[model samples]
Target: MGAAWEPGGAGVLALPSGRLVRGRSLRALPPGPPPQFALYLAARPVAPAQWESRWLRWLDFRLPADPGAVADALREAWQRAATERVEIACAGGLGRTGTALACLAVLDGVPPGEAVAFVRERYARRAVETAGQRRFVRRFGGLATNDPSVAE
Candidate 1:
């Protein structure tokens, strides 16, 4: 695994591809330069026009995100992480952010069944907080394909 950008900080998970992406609660963002790209998940739209971010209306606390959008967003985030600082954030960060991180892990070649544990072990003990979210990660393998639809 690649080293975290900020060890023991909010949370950072390294993809098998060697891309390091930070995961944090919008409330726990450390003091420092902002990430070049941020993917924000929330019940409501929280990203402002001024931030270089993408907001995915995730709504429920532990429910999975829209499958279609999740695939596209993860693909974008993964590609951006290759050459830029990428961060993923949610309300408290552990649940949604962790879920997203696990999906990214799957996209990076981790088996879907192990993706959740992978994120929790590296990102936070409480990562990927809901049964539904766990199920989402387990089913994420299909989204790992290089189909162009994932980028749309």
Candidate 2:
């Protein structure tokens, strides 16, 4: 919670609240100042990098293995984005990273129904690849809030 990303810079996504988070592929990680915190969604254990990071057990082109943990991590990322260089990433970046970014978008006040489209337009054109991933984004607001009324 010590820095902020330049809005519209490189891979950064500017949230509605003016916070920013970068979304990228670990495979082709861009050159830049390292993030203070990152949320990594991957099936295998991710070795820690110099900067802080949290890895969620998630598969490519699919939903997270633990939705609760993902919601928690996304919330952390969203909060950290207020003053830190926050990032969300996965192997391909389009599927898992995009899905996570969509979830974060929802956390930032984007409607769940439009989060996927919002992320695609702002983050990547092909964000949230699979139908299942799309469904996860749609239901993410409920998952984040633990809102039983919102349905799974």
Evaluated at residue 54, the lDDT of candidate 2 is: 92
Q: Assess each prediction's global lDDT (C-alpha) against the native.
A: 0.79, 0.87
Q: Which lDDT tens digits does candidate 1 get at residues 15-53?
A: 778788999888766776568888999988884835588
Candidate 1 displacement at residue 32 in angstroms? 2.4
Candidate 1 at 81: error in angstroms?
A: 0.4
Which residues of candidate 1, in runs, are more than 4 Å off?
1-9, 144-152
Kindly list the per-residue Cα lDDT of model 2 for residues 33-98, writing each as its tens digit. Answer: 889999888899788888989989998877788888888899998988898999998997799988
Worst 10 residues of 2 by lDDT: 143-152
TM-score, per-candidate, Cα-based = 0.85, 0.93
User: Model 2, stretches more than 4 Å misplaced?
Assistant: 148-152
**In angstroms, how far off is 47's CA in candidate 2?**
1.9
Q: Which candidate is the best by lDDT?
A: 2
Looking at model 1, the pairs that clash are none
